[model samples]
Target: MIRTVEVREARELLDHLLPLIASPWLYVVVFAIVAIDGFIPAMPSDPVVIGLAALSASGPPDVVMLAAVVITGGLAGDRVAYLLGRTAGHRVRNPKLVMAKQKAERALRRHGGGAILVGRFLPYGRTATAMTAGSAGLPPSRFTLHTTLAAVAWATYAIGLGRLGGETFARSPLLGAAFGIALGMVIGGAYTLVERRRAKTAAEEPEPELVASGRR
Candidate 1:
């Protein structure tokens, strides 16, 4: 009963909020959401980008501008997170986050420029990479170079999915947006699942044996 009420209320709130955010300010709204989400993993910026891009098929905020805004927002937000990590990295206490941070640090060390690029698709991945990079003392030039590439690729991927929905449902804006958001969620979920499976497989592999000290 409570879950149903909450869902209904959330829908009502979304319906109420949509019109309020549906104009020239739409760009600003999406940009802010994506940027803030860079540091704080609270909002679903991917769906917003996908939905807006799908609506762009109906011809309002130009697709180019929307794409630029999302990419720039992602870059800006991640850079800020990186900056914050420089000061706050040592303060992490939660066991899970600590493990994640250590893993990200190792990835940064092993892969150098593109570690974060590959991981950005996973949930909370941007934060993990940026923060770990900053805390790990990774050079700003290298981090920025790769993160820029990652942001552009991420934006393109999200917008592409939206465009797919828009093209498929040319006459129905709502349907296009709904389809795009759903598709992004499905793909992101699948990617995360695959990564987890891979991680498990790698963990289960046995390490090579070392020679005994007297054998030589």
Candidate 2:
């Protein structure tokens, strides 16, 4: 995967980004990016947070503060996205998207905040789930509670990953940050592949026949 052009570009980008985040303004950058990521699925918040956290762990004593900032930003962004969904839900004219939103609504209604918590881990899952929740008229208090839980879990996991990379490459925090990002990509890719295989297998598998019941 590191041999791929995308990976190389990502490496270069993170390498460039890591240095910019080392200053006293690190907190602001982390918070802004994490918050922006909540509504913008393409924002790539994970890499930035991972990189900053790696540097923080290796060079500074502020990783704890970083986590707090990230969680706050994440919660803020999620709320904004939820509100956006509520306002824009009716404006969605695409049939496919509408159908998808309907399905999401059903799932959210049935499962409650668990769906929101789960979505926070999946790529682009948080934005979609949050928006759908708002659109579906899920209560604000419930959404906030679940979003808070998800933010904490996500922040802790991301920081831990960064810390692992930082500790592994203590001599070169930049390389460690890159490693963390790459590791995250590999994990996400593997999860996606496994899910696809599961879906395919389920689709292909035949249902059991009820011979004992004497179905005609």
Candidate 3:
């Protein structure tokens, strides 16, 4: 019941914001949402980007402008998360996160730029890759270059999905909204399942060091 209510409330909130996002200040709103959403993992910026693309279908702003806004918003949002990692990298010592630490460091060391480029396409990859890159002490210029390129590709893909919906439904905003929500739910659900599986596997695994040392 509570979960359903929260979903309903969230849907209502997104619906309420549609008109506001379509306003002349859309870019500013998107930029702010994207930036904050990255820092706070729960909030998603994809819906707003898709909304803007839908608005562009019947509206005044150019598609290019919408795309630019989405890209800028994403990059800005990622930077906030990246900066957080850069500053707080030392203090974060979670066993789960730490388990991935060596792999992340190895990725950067071996693959260098390509790993960061491809990692951006992943769900938690953007922030996680950025955080790992920071923790591994990758150069800022290299990190920014890869992140910027990845952001452009990601923004293009997201906005393109909305545009495809917009064009397919004869520029109908309703269709775009539907597509965005559906995609968000699917991706969100998949992410949840992956996390649960990872947790389960981690819980089931024996501690190699403890086993070897006969401590358990």
Candidate 4:
């Protein structure tokens, strides 16, 4: 069933599921989005988190509970990435991405848990930091402790923005804006992926040669 799932349909299903989010179910959405975001770099969780915050105003879920679930979800999702980095961390040899990640790992070595704390504010850093910690052989307990704190701060800020949107603008307007922003990001990301692939292919090919005597 998962094999046949289309991205648009999956997103639409998520939209339908959004209104039903309340009580325990809210946690499910939080974890799902966070997990997907951590597992796949392309999936954006900020809008989903924000959208959930907006929904909370009308649903049975309260702010405190919403915040807690979001933090838990984000932490859970991040842990998976950390483990992946730990297990297969050495497999990724791309100098471009690796050099960036190495800087984060070096910081982890110097600052210990402090690196993860600072990494929370960064986009790519958040996931790479976790991997860096794991790869650096940090203890699980220490990783979890700092990661939990970071997750709470991250979720709070994201959800707060969503809540602010719901408060400042009407629900319909906020939802429309959020949807447009999400769609734009998706298109931009897809275009980037396609362009990168084209560039990579072009770089691998041989250049055309000039005619030998101009009389073939």
TM-score of each: 0.82, 0.79, 0.70, 0.66
- Ten residues in sequence with the least summed lDDT for candidate 4: 207-216
lDDT of 2 by residue, 7-58 (tens): 5544555556655665667677668878987886556678777766777766
| TM-score of candidate 4 relative to the true fold | 0.66
lDDT, candidate 2, equals: 0.72
Q: Distance (Å) between predicted and true CA of 80, model 4?
A: 1.8
Candidate order (TM-score): 1, 2, 3, 4
Per model, how many backbone clashes are there? 0, 0, 0, 0
In what order do the candidates fall by lDDT, top score first?
2, 1, 4, 3
Task: Write the residue-wise lDDT of candidate 4 on 1-216 in tens digits.
Answer: 011123454456457665666547757766777766654544556655666666555554576777876787778777987897889888766564476476566556456777787666554567778777776677788889889888877776666665655555555644643543354345447755775587576656554422212211
CA RMSD of each candidate after superposition: 7.1, 7.8, 7.6, 13.0
Off by over 4 Å in 4: 1-14, 22-26, 58-61, 93-100, 170-216
Per-candidate local distance difference test: 0.72, 0.72, 0.60, 0.63
Give the lDDT of residue 66 in candidate 1. Answer: 87
lDDT (10s digit) by residue, model 3, range 13-48? 467666665476766766676666545544556655
Lowest summed lDDT over 10 consecutive residues: which window, candidate 3? 207-216
* Candidate 2 residue pairs in backbone clash: none
Better of 3 and 4 by TM-score: 3
Residue 187 local lDDT, model 4: 45
